[model samples]
Structure formats: structure tokens, C-alpha cells
Target chain A: MAFGIGSGIFFAHMPFLKLNGIPGTTYRVMPGLISKRLTNRLGINFQAESFGNNRQKGMDELDRVLDRGFPVGMLTSVYYLPYLPKAFRFHFNAHNLLIYGKQNGEYLVSDPVLDFTTTISPKDLERARFPKGVLAPNGRMYYPVSVPEKVDFNPAIKKAIRWSGFENIMTPPFLPFFGSRAINYMANKVAKYPTAMDERKAILFLGNIVRMQEEIGTGGAGFRFIYAAFLQQAAKRLDNPELSLLSKEMTGIGDQWRDFAFSAGRICKGRQAGNEDFKSIANLLMDIGDKESAFFHKLRKVKM
Target chain B: MKANEVPQDDSGVIGGKFTGLKYATDENGNYVEVQSIGWDAEITVLSQAWDEVNEQAKEALEKVKAGQWSTLAYHSTKCMMNEAMLSEYMDMSKAKVKEHLYNPAAFAALPAATKEKYAEVLNIDLNELLRAE
Candidate 1:
């Protein structure tokens, strides 16, 4: 079974039939394991080194490797990979990909995570973190070999190397933050109108609150509490001829739906459940809210 | 005539361009012209308070961008709703309502009012709660 597994792993790393006639070097290494099989096949002598489980050490190792004119490739856990420099260019969480390559005085990279390949100027690479400077104390660094050009580097390996440049790129602000900003912007807009449109404004505010809760995983509890308060306030300001019992009933139903969703499952778990799951749920909830908000926004436009 | 004394006319005819000259009779019976040039200056400085406010807002927006608000909201809600439910209930003022009503040793202690309200709303008590038992 072990031999079969080894053979399967080996064949998996081999270039497909299309790559057979292609020129260039190819190397593959599984995460957390040394690429002895790939090294033997390439007929290259390479050494493996690990930065003592911290970003600073990793950064230092990165500087040392680049200073010595040797290129480095890293394979690390998903959590650590995103925090590294040039993370967007590489798939730090994946099976196999290179992080750097050189062609015609330009360095090209293919990051599997971002699913994109780009060529960066030599100047940029020189200023790059892993290649030019020390790693953070908590960062991790892995290099396949200490020597340059000993292994026949294939396009796949080149692509993977190029891709690793995107490790630790900053992610954009999340949808929730945008939703909050949108809510605040809309609230300030509503506040400018006079007393005659107070009910309408309150309704719009409630609608936005609902939208925010739904879209950003802001949660039904907070929205429900706020909506209830808004409704009570709107009841005192009921001067509109259009305000009717049916409108209140509909709003009530919406609130009930939100409450049901909020209390539906074990929504409130402790820290032990893992942050990733919570983030996933928050993202999913935000997506749903954003869709709902879009529907309501269209409705509001039609009303206007 | 010497170049310096070529033409001292108030009229702009001596030069191709117009000139700022005023002619007057001198004590020595020679015509003299006075010329003057005008200049203006202005200065402005930005307010430090405005810059500080702008910087603060930018930092707040960045923190929001970094997912700080969402993280805080998630943790706060979890603490308030889940963990707080398992502890002994206390009043809004944090005063103990009853000996059995509030369990200081519970996983998440809460004020009596918040506990009672949550318990009443959630339909669970200390004995029936999973985290408490």
C-alpha cells in the first residue's frame, strides 16, 4: 500500500502528456514533506531548511537565502500563508506551486490561490520581503535547495515560484464594514429631511437595518431590538394618510422572520467551535442580507 | 546722441511695447519720467485640528477594513447570549437577586436582569442549561 501510494504520488507530480514536449524544468513538493522524489527525478542536489516556526525567523531566512543568490519556495498552512508578504501571488494553502522565476530580466510568478500569473520587475523582487528582508517572528519559511540552477526548473515550478510573491497581501475590507458605512451614510441622508417624512424615514431606516443585518451578518437580535424601538417611535409620529395597519403587520412579519432565523440553530457557540466556522457563517449571512438589501433598494426606487 | 539719452518720451513711441512713464519738468529744464512696478503677496496655512480629525477617521475606517468591528460584534454577541446564559443571573445593577438565581461559579455569569430576561426569552434555566450543568 505504501509503495502504491508512493507511486501514485510520484505520477501525480509528473507532467501531463501535453508537457512532455515542452522545454524547461519541473519540480513538485507536497506541503510539510521534502521533495526527495522530485529531486531524484530532476537529478539535482538540493537541501531543505525550515525557519524556526516564527515570522521573524522566516523573514531572516528569506533574506539570507536571497542574499546568497538562491531562490526560495514555501509551502505552509492556510492560516500562516495569508499573513505573509506577496500572498496573493501564490497558493500557500495548496498542493504544489512555485513562488519565483526569471525570464528575460523579468521575474514571472503564478499563484494558484489567486489563479493568476504575473511578471514583476527585478526592482520589485529586490524590494520584496521574503527575498530582501527578514521574516516576522511568527512567520514560516521553507526552501527546496540552497543552490541556484542545480535543478532544471520547469514552467510549473516557475509559475509556482512567481505565484508565491503574493503571500501576505492585504485583503480588502469585508462586506460587513461596507454595509455599516452604507447604513451610516443613509442614516445621515435621512436625518436631513423634515417632519412630514418622519414615518417614511423611519421605515427606510428599519429597512436598511434589516438589510445590514442580513447582508453583513449583523444579526437579527440587534436589528430586531432597533426595529422594535423604531416602530414604537414611528407610532407616535403617525400623520401620513398612507400609514395603515397592514404596513405594521408586514413589518412585524419581517421582524419575526429575522428573529426565527437568529434563534433557529446553535447560533451562539463558545470560542472552542473555531473562528473559521464563525467567519464562514458571517460571510454567508452577509451575502444573504446584501441580496435582500438589493431587492429593497429596488423597491424603494420604484416607490420614489 | 548717446544711447542713454536717445529718447526720454512719455509717449510709448520710443519702444515697441507700452511703458509705465510719467513726464515732469525738472529744475534743470530737462524732461524726466517716473516709472513704477507693482507687486502683491499672499499666504495661507492648513489647520492642524482638521488634519488630526482626517487622520483619526482614516484610522477608524482602516480598523473597520481590518474586520475589527465584525470580530468584536461576533465575540460580544457570543459572550452576551451563550456564555452569559450559563452563569447565575444578576440584576441590571449587578446586585444578586437570589442565592440560587445567581451562580458565581457558572461558565458565564450575568447580571440578574439580563439573565432573567434571557432565560425567560430563551425558555431555559440553570438546571436545564447545557453549559451550566
Candidate 2:
């Protein structure tokens, strides 16, 4: 997995978008952003391409890549990967994994969501790669066609820091559902769930938030830890002790996010006190939003 | 998020069980990457949350078997769409999609363009879509 130069860079800017009429919420990065950032920063020939609604063509491309000894990254729905435990299965179509090789009709998969590498039959893999939903994978995949023999980490880290900072702070507030504004937007909306929805529906909604934060791959805490890892790597690469200090601070912030998830989980299981209603949940989120806001503010001002 | 904290329980372990890398605190209390076995409490609730989704999908499939709903219902369930999302994908009104869910005969009478749209959105062959899955 590409850590420092991948999702880690976009950590603080990840947003939550709540549809006006839909019951679901999203806390994921938009597809293709990772490849875009990687390509730009690493100066590699990386392309995020889709197979144009043709399953057979997509499968052919996947095989062609594997034949070339290139591990192809694919977008897949979580529910169709039979190798996954039932407990971790969902209809989410944006889960990502890499197919590196095949043996005995089973593809070797490196799913970032999983703790270890696994194999899947081609039939089951096909079902996973083509599940229907918004932003359908349609056999979408990405890979770097060319990579420089030598690369510099310092400049790349600096670029990532600048882009991530700009994207988070400068995101248009009018969108109301993205960037920092999204945190408050979601918090306000969450505050009303207790009165607006029945007990069952309210619990479901809360459960969804926790799942978005903690489940479906790297829980929210994982993102923070990933970013901290990036900072630590960046610090070592650049020999910048300040960046090391920042990494520790980010780790602390990650702990806060974990704490929020734990609180939300308690509420979901009805283990919390009566006062831990929607308002309290919203308050917890607001606390997170505040800390993150301040963290990014300091991040943007850090001198390389 | 540390390696030591990665759960060892089987509840949310994805893709059969395997050990993977996790970040954990070292003796110095600083974070370092280490290999660890898998367990995630988040997956426990996540799996529980899907009960309602699976229930809805199963019910929709039953409607297909009973011939009260078209195979589109089953495909929609497979696609993890509710009526509103299906309506958006099929370009039909939500109420219209719900009506079709209850009246297979009416759905069968839909325009070719509408049927084709549903097939395309569901990523299924149009011919196969007309029949039961």
C-alpha cells in the first residue's frame, strides 16, 4: 500500500456529505483523487481508468496487467468478495484492492481493508468488481505505467502538505457539505436524530456513523495513524525534528477520534447514560471538529 | 490503532483470517509498525447493522419469486439500492418504482427505453433482466 503519498496526505480534508432526501451519509474520499495526487507528486505515469461499462473488456484488461507482472489496483464492492467474512461484508462499491497474480484459478488479492493477503476465485472476483451502485467500479483500476528510478521524499512531502492544507481550508463554504464546514453540518444534523427518528431508526443512523468512522476498512482512527506515520516518515526523510513533533501531536488527535468512536459505539449499544442523546453525540463531534480545525490551522503554518 | 490493539477476535476479521501490520507503541512509548493478528470491534456492529439491509434484499428477492415484482427488484437488492436510489438510477419517480415493485405486470409493460435504463444501471443483460435471476 502507498502510505505516505496516498490517502495519508488527504487525511484532514476527508469530508462528510449528507444528502437532503437520502438516509445515508458518506465519509469517503472521492474516487480517483488518490491516483491523481500520487501521479502529480511522484512524477510517475499513473492513470486511473475505467473500462467503459464493459465487464468482459474490464476482465481482459485485468488479465493483461497481471500477465505483464503489474499488480493492478481495482475498485470493488465489499459484498461480492466471498472471501470476506460475513461480518465485514456490505454493499459499498468503492472498496479498493490489488490483484497481483493468479494461481489455480484464484487471484492473489491485497485488500487494504484486510489484515492479510488472500485469494479469490475468478468467478467471485468478477462479482465483486462489477457490483452495481453509484460510482460503479465498472472494472475501474489504476497503476503507474512508469516510475523514476530515483525519487526525492522531501519535495514530495512538502507538496503533499501544501495541497492537503489548501484543499481543506480553501474549500468553498457554500458547498456546506464538504471540508471543515461538513463537520459542523453533520453535527447539527446529528443533534436532531433523537427527536426526529424513532429509537430503532435513530440507532441505525448512529450505527452508520460509527461504521463510517471505524468500519469499512481503516476506521477513522486508522486514517489519523496513517497520517502520523506519513509525518514520521517525512520527518525521517527530511531530518526535520519539528515534523516529528507534529507527528506525535497528530497521534494524539487520532486518539481523540478513537475516543469519539468509542463514545458513539456506547450510545449505539445503549450503554451510555440518558444524557448521552443526540445532542451529546453532536457535542462530541464538535469537539473533534474543533481539534481538527486547530490542528490544520497549525499545520498550514508549519515552516518546512 | 497500535499493532498490539488490533483485535484478535474473529468477529470482524475480513477474508478468512490472516495476520497484518499494525501501528503499536514501542517500549519508548513511540508508535512503530509491527505485525499483528486481526480483530476489529467495529466490524461486529457493522455486521449487525447490515441485518436490516439483508432483510430488505431477501424480501425483495421473495417478491421476485412470487411474481409480484420484476427481477429488477432482485437486481436492485443485489445492487444495494433502496426504492429511491433505484428510481434515480432508472429515471422513474420513487412512487412509480414502488408501484412496479408491487405490480410486475405494470413493470413488464414499461417502455423499452425505461427497461433498458434499468438493465444498464443494474449492469445486467437486458434479456436476462426480463427473466427471473
Name model 2 segments beyond 4 Å from true.
A7-28, A104-106, A219-222, A271-276, B1-22, B34-41, B54-81, B84-100, B104-133
lDDT of each: 0.30, 0.68
TM-score for every candidate vs. truth? Answer: 0.23, 0.80
Off by over 4 Å in 1: A1-30, A79-97, A101-109, A113-115, A118-140, A144-304, B1-133
What does candidate 2's lDDT look like per residue over A203-241, in tens digits? 676667666555534534646676777777777778888
Task: Name the best candidate (by TM-score).
Answer: 2
Q: lDDT, candidate 1, residue B80?
A: 28
In candidate 2, which residue pairs get closer than 3 Å at backbone N, Cα or C atoms, i.e. clash?
A: B2-B23, B3-B23, B7-B39
User: Which docking class does model 2 fall in?
Assistant: acceptable
DockQ of 1: 0.01
For residues B1-133, what per-residue lDDT tens digits would candidate 1 score against the true structure? 1113212323221122222222222454222333311100000001111222344445544543454422222221222222222222222222233222233333134445554454443335633332320
- Cα lDDT tens digits for candidate 2, B1-133: 5545655555333444544455655555466766444434365456547665666678888888888787877777765667766775566788999877678888889989888888876667789678764
Please, what are the lDDT tens digits per residue for candidate 1 over residues A1-304?
1111111110011112111121111111133333543444445555555544334555455556656666655543222232223211211122233445466766554433333466644443322322211111222334445334554434323222122212111113342122322322323333332232443232232232322233211112223222222322333344322222322432443444344233212222111223343344444444434433443333223210
